[model samples]
Target: MVFWVFGYGSLVWNPGFEYDEKVIGFIKDYRRVFDLACIDHRGTPEDPARTCTLEHIEGAVCWGAAYCVRGRPEKERAAMQYLERRECEYDQKTLVDFFKETDPLRPALSGVIVFTSTPDKVSNKYYLGPAPLEEMAWQIATAVGPCGNNRDYLFSLEKAMFDIGHEDDLVIELANEVRKVLGTMAKEKKLVGSPLKPLKSQTQPQIPTVQLHLLPPEAVAMDL
Candidate 1:
């Protein structure tokens, strides 16, 4: 059986896995949002970096790449293991229908796995939920980790989307905002407001309980 995985964030640019085929496509009813926190890859425990996570929205379409691995079970297993470790921050392994760019109305592949965080921050510890664009941009601009700076992740995704002929508006806006923040910092000859320090006055945003729709039996049956 062929195994399929969907990439919307860093995976779009760096899948870091072996695959038989890659198809550029979009998944329906889901939009990418920079609402997830990363403490290991792109940030420290004290100052987390904002990363991309899928937010379910009506009539939304998230464009990305879909990779399929077949012909050998070991190859597919290795890819899944690597992704599980890389996407450890995500709490859910969502199965989403993938529609090719050439035909958006019909699903080109069913049961494609997508790593996503639960909406409630309590349930998903890494989930940061929504924040103002400026705040997010500030975090992205200043935050750095072992992998690299958070801004690079955002910028790389923006460029990757453009290369694939589908530039995400939200990504572009956030990348531009981060650039502005960086520019301001450079002009000031210092970092902006000591972003590394915890903000005592900042309160956590109220997270609503979002009941995610369950996948069909067939989809669940295809789980790795």
Candidate 2:
């Protein structure tokens, strides 16, 4: 028997599982977006309401990898353990698994667990990466690099969508549109590109201003 998984988040890239045949699987009415809010892995571990959410992200698409595995009962159990080890921090659930389901031929069973949102919090992820709209698109578009957290799920979606010529509203929102100008300044010592030759803006670029870590909205919420 073969096992398949429809990955949407980091699994799109850094999948720790050993499976053959990685393909671009699709699910109708469901799209991938950087919306899940976390607290332990990406954010501070000391915070409460660390629950993550899979909120409604408009015009968004996430690209995931599916693989086929061969093994016995023990192997199956090991695979499940592996998934938990990788995504245990996210806390996956059957409800989210339903959203990730695809076809049987391309059937991806045993959906990896992930942290879900608080249901009361906003669904859309915090736009902590870009300040403007255009820049956000670019970031999502060319966010991939040799090795990094930003290049996994988000890049998969952005790249595949571009290849398929699927540009929707979420891909062209007002907030992301304004981010274009903010990106040209050069992040710092060259996370993506080199410094200006003329030494323009002698001021060194800030780190937190460039890199983004997804944290639960609760972490930043008021005490009230």
Candidate 3:
């Protein structure tokens, strides 16, 4: 049987696993939200970064990529092992119907899996749940970790979505708010207008170029 995994956030840009094929797909009845706090992986415990996760919402659809691993059980096992290690915070796994956007009228692909945690999935200490956009922005703007600035994660994911011609309004709005807060933080810390740039503040915050090997242009262009 072919095994498939769904990616909606950082996984879209950095899957960190090999697969036989990848296709742009959408999962119904759910939406992506940056409500989870990245305490261990993306940020330090003292200053955690906000990250994305799926929330079930009727009539909502989440656009993402589906990875297919087939032909060998060992290959599938190894891929799952890597994913589990990478997504340790996301403890819940659910099988969902993933429909490729290339053919919306057709049935969903076989063997689709999504790793997510709901509010009722027992209160996760890292789960931030819902909060004001400005609050989230401030947290994201100020947090940095071994991986990098927390805002970079948000910026990169937004760019990835835009590269596929899928404009996520929520992410755009949050990024704008985060930049505003970042500017304030820079000024308050006397890090702005200096020869040496602040560690957290970007001079222009341009979108970094990314080559999406997993999501080909044609595969996701239909989503636009």
* Residue range 1-224, candidate 1, lDDT tens digits: 68899999999989998888999999999999999999999998999999999999999999999999897788888889999999999989999999987787889999999998899978888989899999999999999999999999999999999999999999999999999999998977765444576576656676889999999999999994
> Model 3 scores what on Cα lDDT?
0.84
Model with the higher lDDT, candidate 1 or 3: 1
lDDT of 1: 0.93
How would you encode candidate 2's per-residue C-alpha lDDT over 2-83 as one tens digit per residue? 5555555556555676775666544433443343333334343232111112444554334344555657766667766787
The true-versus-predicted C-alpha distance at residue 114 of model 2, in Å, is 8.8
Candidate 3 is scored at a TM of 0.80
Candidate 1 vs candidate 2, TM-score winner: 1
In angstroms, how far off is 60's CA in candidate 1? 0.2
User: Which sections of candidate 3 miss by over 4 Å?
Assistant: 120-122, 191-224
By summed lDDT, the worst window of 10 consecutive residues in model 3 runs over 117-126
Lowest-scoring 10 consecutive residues by lDDT in candidate 1? 189-198
Candidate 3 lDDT over residue span 1-224, tens digit each:
67889999988878988898888878889998988878876788998899999899998888888888887888888999999988877868988888867776564775588999756425677677889999999889888888898999999999988876676888999999998998887787785556774676565687989986787788899888
> Residue 71 in model 3: shift from native, Å?
2.9
In order of listing, the candidates' clash counts read 0, 21, 0
All candidates' TM-scores?
A: 0.83, 0.45, 0.80
Give the distance in Å from residue 168's predicted Cα in candidate 3 to where it truly belongs.
Answer: 1.2
Q: Model 1 compared with the native: what TM-score?
A: 0.83
